[model samples]
Target: MTLEARLAALAAAGQTITYGKLARDLGLRMEELTNALERLMEEDAAAGRPFRAAVLRQRLSPEGLPAPGFFLKAAILGRPAQDPLAFTRAERHALLPFPNIPG
Candidate 1:
């Protein structure tokens, strides 16, 4: 499947997916997935849309260690919605570095 198709499929599933898992599922290297995501983000920005790829780190467990891993989900911005799993402000700042994006 094409990268766009894979992204659409994940968005349709409405679930966040770890990079490692997504890479394996897509038969792509981890770096390939990351590069694709970066390209997608750039495309979205150039089109005057809020980035659709939300990259977030998994939450920690009671032991204060992450339970799963870093993940990304496709989302529509500028809409009335809630992502309980959305990354914290600090996390977004740390993960994304788009100059045109507002926090």
Candidate 2:
């Protein structure tokens, strides 16, 4: 089966997956997975760093946090569509689905 297929099956089972699981499920060694991930990352480097969950910080605590915790969304950089408040008026207008709009 494909890697994505395995990943989807795991996701449907309500289970979280790690690189190790992905590698094992796809009949790949950890090093192979690592190499593939590295190649993907390298390709994305020209378009800003790829967002790897393993590399990105999902949440962070304040410097003086003594309470339960604090959190913020991990950054999704690179693409213009991914950026909020980062478009021209025409660009925003173009995103409207006028054909699907009801009177």
Candidate 3:
């Protein structure tokens, strides 16, 4: 499956994945994953969809939040993210209403 489809499935299931594991599963370098996610974020923004890339967290992220690059991409896409945790939570929630989950 494509990365977007995979991410959408994870979002629908209210699940999150670490960036490292996702990268390995997709046979991608970290940079490649980040670039792809940024493009996805841009498309999501244009399409008025929730940021599916928000489901990608850092391995060491205690709250299951995506890496800083996610936020940067969001900002570049004209999404204001003054609060990273809330922003990601809301995006994930939009995809699937798991309000208590962080990812």
User: Which residue pairs in candidate 2 collide?
Assistant: none
Q: Estimated TM-score per prediction?
A: 0.51, 0.36, 0.88
Q: Output the TM-score of candidate 3.
A: 0.88
| lDDT (CA) per prediction | 0.47, 0.37, 0.88
RMSD of each: 10.6, 11.4, 3.4
- Residue 56 Cα positional deviation in candidate 1, in Å, after optimal superposition: 6.8
Residue-level lDDT tens digits of model 1 in 1-101: 87766655544443345566667888989778777776776676467654445432233333222112122222332222243334323233333335346
Candidate 3 segments whose C-alpha is farther than 4 A from its true place = 97-103
At residue 91, give the lDDT of candidate 1: 30
Best candidate per TM-score, number? 3
How many clashes show up per model?
0, 0, 0
Error of 1 at 46 (Å): 0.7
Tens-digit per-residue lDDT, 52-97, candidate 2: 3122111242221111110112222233333322322222233233
